[model samples]
Every structure is written in structure tokens, then in C-alpha cells.
Target: MEDFRKKLYEDIIIKQISRNNDVETAHKCIETLSRVVNNIIDSPNDERKRRLKEKSKTFQSNICGAQGGVEFLVKIGFRAKVIDFEKFYVLEHPLTDNPDSPEMEKLKVAQEILQDFLKKVKDRAELASKMQAKEKAAEELRRKAVLEKIDEDKERRVAARERLQARRKSQEEQETTINEESNSADDSADTADTTDTQSQPEQFYRAYHSSHYRQPNQKQD
Candidate 1:
């Protein structure tokens, strides 16, 4: 792979010489760009390097090499101006020194910009995790609610079945009582009819015997 840092620095130097016609400013730019490249290249064990490697695999984004490092800062809202030349893009950082050397100030701004970009990435990840947690909570609530509704419906069905069984049992008891009463009444009527039939025959025999004896006696007299 080509050294993108060298390419970018060369482009910046060329543009600075031609457009601004200032070797000192161009040298400053070169130094600053060199420092950025070194910070990234030298720190193989840095957390930023590890994160960028992971990001490159998962997404088409990275902050590792010069090609994506400057672009990444710009994308994350760093106000470093980019002058588009015919063949290359040169980054322009404002030279602001407040009690600090210009080189120190430029380095500080670049560091702050990179740190802020990292913070923004962390914030985005945090927000996404929070949203996922909320969605999971909502799903759990919906699942619980559905289970509760199912339980309630099951209880209602059981209660209704019990009530129906009780009603059926009540109806059966009433029918049994009515049948017993009707059977008792029929038994009483049968006993009264049998007594009347037996008594009439006995009364007829006694009256016939007494009349025969009385006729014999009157004839004798």
C-alpha cells in the first residue's frame, strides 16, 4: 500500500507554495501533518488504534491511516478547511496561538478535535445501546401482558364451566324431588282403592245370614 501520509503532505506543501507563496506556513503545515501521522503510526498499542481497527471491520469507517484520519475528523464536525486543488485536497487549520506557540496550539487543536470525534462515536454507541434496552423492555412488557390476558381468559372459562355444572346439578335435583312427590301420591291412591274393595264383600255376607235366620223363627211361631 502507498504511504497516504506522504501523499497528503506533499499535496499540502505544493499547494501552500503555489497559492500562499509562504515557505514558513508550508513548513508549519508539514510539521503539523507529520505530527498527526506519527501519533497514529507510533501508537500501535493505543486504544484509539484498536477501536479504529474494529470499526474498519464492522463499518466502512476508520481513523487509522492518513487517508481516513483527516476525513474522519472532518466528518465528525472539525472545522478544518479543505482547499480542493486540481488533483488533491489540502487541509487548512487556522493558526491561532494564545500565549502558546503556534506549533503547540495546532497540535492541541488537532488533539481536541480527535478526542471530540471519539467522544461523539462513544455517545452514538451509548445511545444505540440505550434504545435497544428500551425496546427489549417494551417487548418484555408486551409478552407479560399477553400472558396475563391468557391467564385471565382461562380463569373466566373455568368459572363459567363451574357455574354451568352447578346449574345442571340444580336442575337434576329439582327433577328428582318432583318425581318422588308424584310417586308418593300414586301409592296413597292405590292403598285407598284396595281398602274399599275389601270392606264391601264382608258387609254383604253378614246381612244375608241374619235375614235367613229371622225367617225361620217367624214360621215356627
Candidate 2:
């Protein structure tokens, strides 16, 4: 497929130079034609390729097809002219004894310029693909880091909740212990007060009876 495309590009260059002998014009024509060629090369559209090749052979006047023989020469800025297609001047350009021909010289110059252009385009595309891959890798790393951070935060929160629960449980137990001790102390104080109250009444009653009996005995004496 790659070889086919290279041959196709070379054929288009030859055709463009043969028709107009202008490299700049030929380059522009190829620039427009590259889109269709690249698509066919990438996707392998047989029908499209066949149609494009057919279009290349047919000419409006003297101009060749700009893109895969489908696009018109006038569309690519070429003027129409009525010429005998059978008796056309076959100036063998870039690869013939007539290398010194003005048209052939133009073809050579155009070929060099287009080769450089295509190379730069290929290099830029490769660079773009690499950059996109790097971006995707960085994004994946960022996503993983976010997930890890979320897990760490969840674990920390769970630990914090457990610690809080434990502290609350301990505080509740301490409070319960204090309340029980207060109640026991209150009960002991109440029991002591009741015992003192009962003893005091008994002692008072005995003293009163003894005093009354002793006074009567003194009067009899």
C-alpha cells in the first residue's frame, strides 16, 4: 500500500509537470490531491481509487486532473486550451536526455520542494501522535492518584470515627462510675443521720424519768 501511494504521488508529479511544467502549481495540485490519496491509502477504498485513477486520464483540454484525476485543472488555477492530445510534446522531464529543457528543470525543482514538504508533514504528524500518547499517560496517572487520595481520605475518616467513638464510650463509662459513687455516698450519709436521730430520743426519755423519781424521794426524806 505504501509503495502504491509513492508510485501514485510520483505519477501525479510527472503529470502535473508534463502539463504545465510549473513546480509551484504542481505542488498546489498535489497538496489538494493528497487529501484524497491519504484517505484511500489509509482506508483502502477500492472504488474511490479506481474512479480517481480514471479521472486522471481524462482532461478538459491540456490540463491534467489535480486530485487522483477527479478534480479539474481549472479548479487548481489552470487555463483551458485546445490542443491535439495525440500529438502532444512528450518532453521527458527529470528522467530523460532532455534534462536541460526548461520544463524538465522546473519539474526537478518542484520534485525537490514537494519531497521536503511531504517529509515535514510526516514528521509533524508523528510528533503529534507521540504528544497525544504522552498526554493520555499523564491523564491516567492523574486519575490513579486521585483514586488513591480518595481511598486514603476514606480510611482516615474511618479511623477518626473509630477514635471518636472510643473516646465517647470511655467518657460515658467514667460518668456512670461517678454517678454510682455519688449515690453510694448519699446512702451512707442518710443511714448515719437516722441512727443518730433514734439514739438521741431514747437518751432524752431516760433522763426525764430519772429526774422525776429523784425529786419525790427527796421530798419523802
Candidate 3:
């Protein structure tokens, strides 16, 4: 019968406790059991450590009300008892009496299991947190890089526009200077043509007079 009870309680710890509660609550339940086991192991002769009040708020919230909580205590040799009209679960055989017994061995194994589970859960949470932080930092770097690229593109466009505008202004100034020089050359050519036309009229008059007034000595031809 004791062996059967131990088997039943072990199954409860392995399956029911985690199934019935959220992870935080489940861990709390396991931690409570660990403390209880540690207390019993440390003070096997302490009557207080051997007994748990059924109606106590802490016991009800952390242990009795939790699935498989009562069963786990039972597996370690605790039994339901009534004392002075109040109810309690009391250890019948203090595990310290026979540390090498199967019950004591089972208790130690259960403690080991609980500790291992808690450590694994803690490690997983830390790993997840670190991954999230790394991802966030990477995202921030990507965002900054994108913004910098945009700014660089904008600056290049502005510089290109300014250069284009400067080139256009220089071309316009050169055209203006060439047009002014061409106009000055055209004016000088026109003035020289007018002066030549005036001189030609005076020369033509002198030639006509000289031809008419030929040498008087010359005989009529």
C-alpha cells in the first residue's frame, strides 16, 4: 500500500501539478515543496517541521490548494491527522531515521527533480531575454543605417542641383560676354564703311575736274 501511494504521488508530481497551473504558479508550488523537504531534512526531530496545518493561509495557498501538493507530502510519509479538533498532515516516519530507505531516497530524488526543473526554466528565460535584446539592438542599427542613407542621398541631390545651377549661370555669363563683344565689332565695321563712302565722293569730284581741264597745248583729237 505504501509503495502504491508513492507511485501515485510520483505520477501526480510528474504530470498533474504542471498541467493545472500557469508556469509561475507551478514554480511557486514546486519551490514551496522544496522548502518543506529541506526543512524536514535539516531538522528531522523538530515536531513543527514534521507537521503542516491544513487550514493555514500559507499552506492552503502554496501547497494544499495546489494540484499534487498534498500527494507529494504523502509520498514522503506524511499522513492526514486530527489534532485538538484541528486538521494537520504529519510525518509518520521521520526520513532521518532511515536515510537509506526507499522513502528517503524518493524524497531526495523529488527534491533533485524540482531543483533541476527550476534551474532549466531560469536558464531558458535568461536566454530568451538576451536574444530579444540582441534583436532590438540590430533593429536599431538597421533603422539608423536607413536614415543615414536617406540623408546622404538628399545631400547628394542638393549638391548636384547647386553644381548644375552654377554651370548654367557660367554658361549664361559667357554668352552675354560674347554677345557684347560681337556688337562692338559690328559697330566699328559700320563706322569704317561710312568713312570710306565719304572719302570716295571727294575723290570722284577731283578726278572729274582734272579730266575736263586737260592741257590747253594738246590739239583737238
Candidate 4:
């Protein structure tokens, strides 16, 4: 009978794990079950520990709604009853602290399994959190690299534009210098022409005076 009950409870735990598919919910259910078993083992004569209200929030959320919760309780000795149309599961024969008894052994085994399950669940949660954090950090690095590339491109464009503007300014300055030199040459040529014109007028005046001069010994034609 003890072997059969153990097998049955194991099947129920498998069902619970498969049905919930959530670590938190499974953890709560297992924790509650362990607590219930502990209460029964500690205080065998406590009526309240042996009585569980089906409609209560704790029972509904942690036990009744869970797949294997009520079945586990029933296997341990709880029987469903109704009083004033309110449902309850009552343990007529509470668990005793008999280390050799099958019920006590079953409860111990169940506690051991619950503890192991909780440890595994906690480890898995921590691993998942670490993986998520790593992914976020990698994404941040990628974003930073992209921003840096964009800034570098912007700087290169600005530098190229400045270089182009400088080259254009240099060309303009050279053209201005050449134009000034040309204008100076033109001014010098105009001044030379004016000096030559003035000398020619002076020479013509002297020649006319000499050709028509009196009191000078000259042969007449």
C-alpha cells in the first residue's frame, strides 16, 4: 500500500509540474504542501491544522487550483466534506511523529522532493536572469558602436568640407593677386605713353623756331 501511494503521489507531482509550466506557481504549491505536511506531523491533535477550507484563497490559489494539490492531500488522509454548503477537506486521522510508519515516511519523502524541486527552480531562475542581463549588455554595446560610427562619419564630412572651402579661398586669393599685378602693368604703360607725347610736342616747337629764324647765315632755296 505504501509503495502504491508513493507511485500515485509521484504521478501527481509530474502532472503538477507539467500542467503549471510556471516555476513560481509550482514553487508555491510545493511549499504549501510541505507546510501542510509539517503541520500535521508537528501537531497531530490540532484540529485546525487538519482542516482546510476549499473556498479559501490560500487553498484555491495554492492547492485547489494546482493540479496535484487536492490529490496529494487526499492521499495523505484528507476527505472532502460539506458543512452548511461550504466545502472543506478534513483529515480525520492526522499524521503522527512515527518515524517507521508509512504515512510519516511518505511525508518525509515528499518534503525531500519538494526541497530538491525548490532548489532546482531557484537555480534555473538565477541562470535565466543572468542570460537576460548578458543579452541586454550586448545590445547596449552594439548601439554604442553604431552611434560612434555615425559621429565619426559626421566628423569626416565636416573636415572634407573645410578642406574644400580652404582650397577655394586659396584659388580666389591667387586670382586677386594676378589681377592686381596686371592692373599695375597697365598703369605703367599709360604713364610712359604720356611722357613720350609731351617730349614730341617740345621737339616740334624747337624745330619750327629753328627753320624760321632771322639773323642766321643760311642758304635760301
Q: Per-residue lDDT of 128-169 in model 2, one digit per residue for the tens?
A: 678889999999999999999999999999999999999999
Off by over 4 Å in 4: 5-9, 18-20, 64-66, 83-85, 143-221
C-alpha lDDT (0 to 100) for residue 205 of candidate 4 = 39
TM-score of 1: 0.45
lDDT of 1 by residue, 53-102 (tens): 22332222222222344443343223332233222222233232242744
Candidates 1 and 3 compared: the better one by TM-score is 3
RMSD of 4: 6.6
Task: Summarize candidate 3's per-residue lDDT along 1-221 as a digit string, tens digits.
Answer: 45654564457655777677655566677788888878877777788988999999878998877888887778667899999999999986655567787766766776677777667545755776788899999999999999999999999999999999999999999999999999999999999999888888443434446558788798877
- Over the full model, what C-alpha lDDT does candidate 2 score relative to the true structure? 0.50
lDDT, residue 83, model 1: 32
Range of the 10 consecutive residues with the lowest summed lDDT in candidate 4: 201-210
- TM-scores of the models, in the given order? 0.45, 0.48, 0.50, 0.58
Reference-based TM-score, model 3: 0.50
Give the CA lDDT, 0 to 100, for residue 119 in model 4. 76
lDDT of 2 at 94: 22
Question: Which regions of candidate 2 deviate over 4 angstroms?
Answer: 1-112, 201-221
Stronger candidate by lDDT (1 vs 3): 3
What residue pairs are clashing in model 1?
Answer: none
Cα-based lDDT at residue 40, candidate 1: 39
Clashes of 2: 2
Candidate 4 residue 138 C-alpha distance from true site, Å: 3.5
Note each model's CA RMSD in angstroms: 14.5, 12.0, 8.5, 6.6
**Would you list the clashing residue pairs of candidate 2?**
55-69, 56-69
